[model samples]
Target: MNKAYVTFRDQKSRDRALAVLDEFRWRKSTLTSKIAEAAPDPIVKAPEMPVTLSFDPDDKTPVNEKVVKSTTPLYNVTYEEQLEQKKKAAYSVMRKLGNEMAKTNPELQQFVRFHKLRRKGQICEVDDIKASPEDVC
Candidate 1:
């Protein structure tokens, strides 16, 4: 088995990698629950507002204003709820991907484990294991 360490030259790459890992973890844990929670609720059309206009003869100007109003759906979730739902979805995807990777490249399994360890500062070196030609699924 080969160990792989997570490294990025820039903060953006590091952040992106970390986010991907987090999403993967979430995907593995609560995929079904997240999907069920995110299912679309009953759709309702928003109420339209009336438009009013006024004309000023002195300046020969027409002023128009629209009163726009919106109502939240009964099943609408809060921002925090939405974020949690997203995190769950991400975890599900990550879990699936990890499983696929394990099947295709058994060596990569160790790399992922090492990466996780490195992330926690529990590991210092990650061996770069090359996959066998037959294992390259």
Candidate 2:
């Protein structure tokens, strides 16, 4: 049988380790609470109510694409094109948030393993990773 030896430099080193552990615990709890708070509340059933639907043939109107094109300025864009632009903008924002979180959060960075995993073509889910300040130590 083989025995392993373990040692701490002094009382201060032990205290520091304990402090780091406590901080990690506190941060984990805080993250849990924050996640819970951010989650959507469960839906509850309410008393059922009768609903009515009505349609009128006169209300139906066809969109005039030619008229729309004539009215739009040469530089103006369509709604579908604008929506695609917005989606790209939102994606960029999410990527920026992920980068910022990776920079600030060590546990998240660990979970991401950005240096190792990025090379392997793996990406982290931003919301799933929790980081603690003690991770830096």
Candidate 3:
């Protein structure tokens, strides 16, 4: 390991980092640190505050009901209820996504007919042409 420059969100954090670095001991060697001598041309900017993620009861957006139910306290839920919720969630996801995907991608809809024939043993496998890589070096 060589040297590293660490940036902190606040001066307190930077001070703590410097203190830790100053007396840092690794293996049988002790490490030393020093403050930067010059200020940067454009001083480093602190990172933005993280997005607040508190849920609002008034929000109308669709939510995964199963997720909220499953994450509840264990004592309030049963094994059978959890299993049923999982099955419903899985089924709804697959049904919705599959339909939307088929509607958006024409090629998927084209393959649907072939898939039906394949399931009925009306389609046969064909060998794909394999191309050998050409060395251009």
Candidate 4:
């Protein structure tokens, strides 16, 4: 049994294809087809305009063997966003620490108890860690 799904940019093309394919005799067998309703949201979206870049071997640009690239973020982030990202990462690390401390150290249980209680703020909480008191509140 052969099965396939198709999508066209317009409804006219879809209708035409379905009309041509539906109940048509092919290789001594009849074909079954219908206009399938597509979901409101596409499974994956194609970029409006795609750019495909490839390395050029023929173009001679002298490759420097001892060149060091700059260690910079690809996307620009505001100070508040950066701080929030760091806080989320710190919370993840703290949760892992809490799990290990709970199992490994009974001596630190009394100290860890306070942290565990306050975990409602630390665990899974994403907030700007370096914001002013007024801005944070």
Candidate 5:
């Protein structure tokens, strides 16, 4: 076993020890504050660039490319892309509904055929089928 003994010979020695402790405390506080003041502020970065997308049904996968338009932000581009996706989904639902209607209404079939012919650059009549008022009810 080991024992250590600390002795203050007189009041003067005790006062000197206290003064050293006080100086050490003051140094520590000043050093801490100095470090805090010297610390640099955090850095902020700009958001990512905007993207423009094109849908090609023929290809197995979708293609996307980044576009840098003047006066347009990334968030706006993303929002526009979302709206375009929604429009595409709505069109898909409309086509499905048209196909279902073609079972009962031969007129819709002719309209669909007409659109196909028009897409192929052939001259076609612009006849659109309308449901009878009674059928709607």
Candidate 6:
């Protein structure tokens, strides 16, 4: 039922509404308290080992000397280096295209320069490729 009685006019209706609200509040508080009381207590920690049994001299061992070499050259360049190379390649291509466009039409020189300068820094840092240039603009 909707608690908001918009059309209630008489004094009796208002008194009854107030009583209902008080009962609702009382029931909510009691329910919350009961739930909290029934909740599980914080977990207990395990006991620590005795001093005599804690450490052993025999447990200490030298590091392994064996080394394994891979046959494939797959990891010659790391993922980060590869991503950097790709970004550099992309920006280089963008610069070349902008240079050509500016040369072909002198009217577009300012626009091409704007495009080139906008992507001067780490182009790969931005997630949105299209908006990267617009951001600088």
lDDT of 3 by residue, 1-137 (tens): 57777777998988888888896898887888777666754434333445576778897755666466556644466666665666556555545555566688777865644653663321224233333456756
Worst 10 residues of 6 by lDDT: 30-39
Question: Which lDDT tens digits does candidate 2 get at residues 1-137?
Answer: 22223356886775666556443544335211111123444442232444566556675445575456557633377556665666556556666666677788766876556643563323433332223455686
Task: After superposing candidate 4 on the true structure, give the runs of residues whose Cα lies further than 4 Å from its correct spot.
Answer: 1-70, 106-114, 121-128, 131-137
- Candidate 5 has its poorest 10 consecutive residues by lDDT at 30-39
Q: Please state the error at residue 13 of candidate 2 in Å.
A: 32
lDDT per residue (tens digit) for residues 1-137 in model 5: 22223357886886676566443545335211111123343442223445567656676542232233333334445555755666556556655665666667786788766664564422233233333465565
Candidate 5 scores a C-alpha RMSD against the true structure in Å of 28.5
Candidate 5 collision pairs = none
Name the candidate, 3 or 6, with the larger TM-score value: 6
Q: What is the Cα-based lDDT of residue 90 in candidate 6?
A: 76
User: What lDDT is reached at residue 97 by model 1?
Assistant: 66
The true-versus-predicted C-alpha distance at residue 134 of model 3, in Å, is 57
Better of 1 and 3 by TM-score: 1
How well does candidate 2 score on lDDT at residue 55? Answer: 52
TM-score of 4: 0.33
* Tens digit per residue, CA lDDT, model 6, 30-115: 21111112344444322343345444567554323111113433356766666676666776776677777879989988876665
Let me know the TM-score candidate 2 reaches against the reference structure: 0.29
Q: Which tens-of-lDDT digit does each residue in 54-85 have in candidate 4? A: 67879565554212212435246776787777
Superposition TM-score, candidate 5 onto the true structure: 0.27
Model 4: per-residue Cα lDDT at residue 109: 69
Ten contiguous residues with the weakest lDDT in model 4: 65-74
